[model samples]
Target: MVYDTVVIGLGPAGSTVLYHLAGRGFRVVGIDMARFPRYKSCGGCISVKVGELLDFDISHLIEHTVYGATFTYRCARMMDIISDEVVGYNIMRDRFDHHLLEQARKRGAEVVEGLRVVDVVEKKGYVEVECDEGRTFKGSFLVGADGASGITGRKVFGMDRRRSAVSVTAEVPYRSEDLGMEIDGRLFIDFGSVPYGYGWIFPKERYLSVGIAGDTLKVGGRIKDFFNTLVRGHTLLKGLRIGERVGWTVPTFYGEMPLPVKGRIALVGDTGHLVDPFLGEGIYYAIKTASMASSVIGDAIESGTPDLSTYGEMLKGEIYPEFTSAERLSDLVYNHPRLWYRMIEKEPEIMYRFYDVIRGKESFGVFYRWIWSKVRSKPWKVLRRWLESRFLPA
Candidate 1:
């Protein structure tokens, strides 16, 4: 039987697609390899801007409402930047993802769990997805949210399999009383602690989600060393014990980002490499892009033609430009972390303005140009410090 849409991977992107389409009174089926409430290796912090997009109440799942960050350099020379307004929400990925999946199910989407999709093919009028147990599902359109390394994205879409960032993560259990409320509402972000990525400590009710990510090709080999340095040097984690560490592939946007839609199949989230290059943030983009993909999909179903050109247009216009600007900033900051750190330390307003970007009030492209304008005026000052930081020993 053919449904209106077949969604592979019930993560945020997949669930968002399923939720929207099913709410439109279309028959949508979502399939995932894992059962609900499964563990996901991530920092799991949702920016405050996300709440604006979500129509439901996620207050129940929020473990912490973040206000600002404590920035450190190699776990030293700490600088605290606290904001008056809330910045983000922290939650565990398992419960958060399960909540999203259930939202889709309640909206009339059929869910298939613990079944791996072995193959996907687009035929004359529909797409066919074959599972491991010889069961086949057909749909008018296929939404590949299976993730960066998911079979649907790699095999079916023939997408580039190279991950942009390599990361190691662990949930270190701890009681809030031991650390006190000082840790509440503030995130710990450390720079110059790793090669190309930064170390992060996002507090939860009973654990600290700790991790670091860097450009995979550039620093992938030394990620373990970087992670070890972070865990060993961070003051807050001094005497705590760390559990089994897990490695995850973060497929950030890099070289030529092609349009994710083709014929009756369209890719969303990690499958399309829709992550931020600088921050390695995917949760926001996953849900944001999922909306764009689902809108055109809904229109195609109504028109009785799976014409997805509009989806491609939407991505190129709305999403791709932001990633491009972020890639430029990533190169500058990662290449000269010490200079960048010093600059931010001296001028806290720079970081404050960036908070506006995160809050959706300013665009990254605009912010990139704004920061460059500041640096261009004092070329000699920047040159002297940048050279000193580069050639001199830390």
Candidate 2:
């Protein structure tokens, strides 16, 4: 059967796009390989901005309200920040993704679960997707939200895959009055405990999600070692019972794809490599970019303009700058891991300011000014330390 739009991967991005397009009275088909409510390895924190975009009552689904975050550096210096307002929500991906998929179905999108798209071919005016069950579907527009390793990105976009940081996360059920009533219910990020990355403890209603992510290419040992250390040695979490360990690789950067769109094809979410570098957050960008892609595609389909030029340009204009900036930052952070640790050591207040930038609560100029002030305050000391460390070697 011919569909107006076929969206592969019913995760956040796909679901958001399908929900918007179907609600507009378009014939949409949403496909996913996995069943609903499948567990995914993620931090599971959602910013308040995401709640507003989803238009769903996040309070109902959130396991906890994250007031802000705490940063602890290798030098044993720590700094905490309280949000001016509620910044985000913490949720389990299994429940969150399922809720989004159900929303798409309720909006009149045809959701097909447990069906994997085995092959895709572009024809004169449409794209053909063949599922593993020998069923075939055609659509004037195809969106790939299938994820980093999914076929849509690998086969169609010609994006060469490269691995960066890997994280092993475990959600353990715990109950302690001290732990349960955490001050400000903030996410605690521990640096220096792990090299090239940080460890996090995100609180939930009845459980705590603990994990560590580090640059796999630079770190000499296995990531499991870091996970083990966090669970076993961390003072704050020594008593928690072990539950389930989930691990996943995080892509730190995205080189230019050969084409984000071809005849009747467009890639969104992880398929387009939209994950953030510093925090390894993707859901916010995924949903936002997916909505943008849907608006452009929906307009093109209604106007009978199938070239998809406008959609490509729109993505370039809206999303590329942010990704470019993130790529530069990731390069610096990963290359000179000590620079981050030093900043925390010399000026711990900068860490809170950095968190503000990450949470979108403050402008980049604030971070830049803080960096400039620090450099000016002790130019020679900072320079000498960097040079001595580089030449002396560990």
Candidate 3:
């Protein structure tokens, strides 16, 4: 049976796209290899922008809310940046993704789980997805959200697979008595901890998500070593027991992966290499870009035009520019840790702008430029920065 859209992968991007399309009264079917509430190796932090886009309140599902971050350099220098407002919520991907998938299903999208797509074929008027169960599904358009290494990307879109970054993650059980310090509900970002990469610790209710990500070609071979160094060198996690160490390849946008929309098939999330180059943040981009892809797709369906170049155009206008700036900043900041650390050492308030960047209050390029401008006129603001850092809790 042919449907309006056949979505491969039930993660945030694909599920959200299916939800939006089905809400518009389109016949959408979503398929995924994993069952509901399956494990996904992710930090599972969602920004406020993502919540607004989906019009879904994720606070109920949030395990913890962080108000600030402690940035450390190679386990030595540390800078604490605190804020009165909540930064982001720490969540579990298993629950978070299943929630979004269920929303799509409730909106009239048919969900098929526990089946893997073995092959994809683009025919005259519809696309065919052959599954492992010998079942074939057809749709006017196909969306591949099966992650960075999923077959839909290469088989359907003919995308060449390459390494962007390798993410190594571990979750440690948290006990109140085991914690030496009070859980002030702050996140942690460690720099200079890995070669061409960084480490993070996001607190959850009962566990802490700790991981590191680095450039695939440069540090992929040393990910294990980097992870080991991160855990060993971390000041707070010295005595805690860690578990469930897993590694996955994250695709970063570098122009090699083409714009996902073409013909009748479009890619979303990791399949399109939509993860941020600097921070390795994909959840926000996945939902954000999927919203755009779904809008243009609705237009395509209404006009009876199979051409999806509009979706590509919309991405170029809205999403690609931020990635360009992020890639540049990733090279500069991750490459020169000492320079960044020293700069923040002098002007600690600079980290506040980073909070704004993460919260979507400002763009990375704009924040970087703002910091550069402040650095150029350092003599004028030296007293102000000193007074603020000395008096403020951060």
The prediction achieving the highest TM-score against the true structure is 1
TM-score of 3: 0.92
- Stretches > 4 Å off in candidate 1: 391-393
TM-score of each: 0.97, 0.89, 0.92
All-Cα superposition RMSD per candidate: 1.4, 3.0, 4.7
Ten-residue region with minimum lDDT total, candidate 2: 72-81
lDDT of the candidates, in the order given: 0.87, 0.76, 0.83
lDDT of 2 by residue, 1-394 (tens): 6899999998998999999999889999988899988877888888766865777665678988876777655423556665565667889998989998888899899999999998889887888888987988899899999886578877887766554577889887877665533445688777755667788888777777888988766665578887887677555576668777887876554546454777678888887776776677889878987888898889878998887766678767766655666656656555565656566666656655665666676644446555667766988987788777567433
Instruction: Write model 3 residue lDDT over 251-295, tens digit each, in one string.
Output: 878766667877898888888888888888899998887888888
Clashing pairs in 2: none
| lDDT of candidate 1 over 107-189, digit per residue (tens) | 88999999999899999999999998898999999999988768866776566656578899989999766663378678999
Question: Order of all candidates by TM-score, from best down to worst?
Answer: 1, 3, 2
> What lDDT does candidate 1 reach at residue 5?
95
Query: Residue 37 of model 1: what lDDT?
Result: 88
- In model 2, what is the error at residue 254, expressed in angstroms? 2.7
Steric clashes per prediction: 0, 0, 0
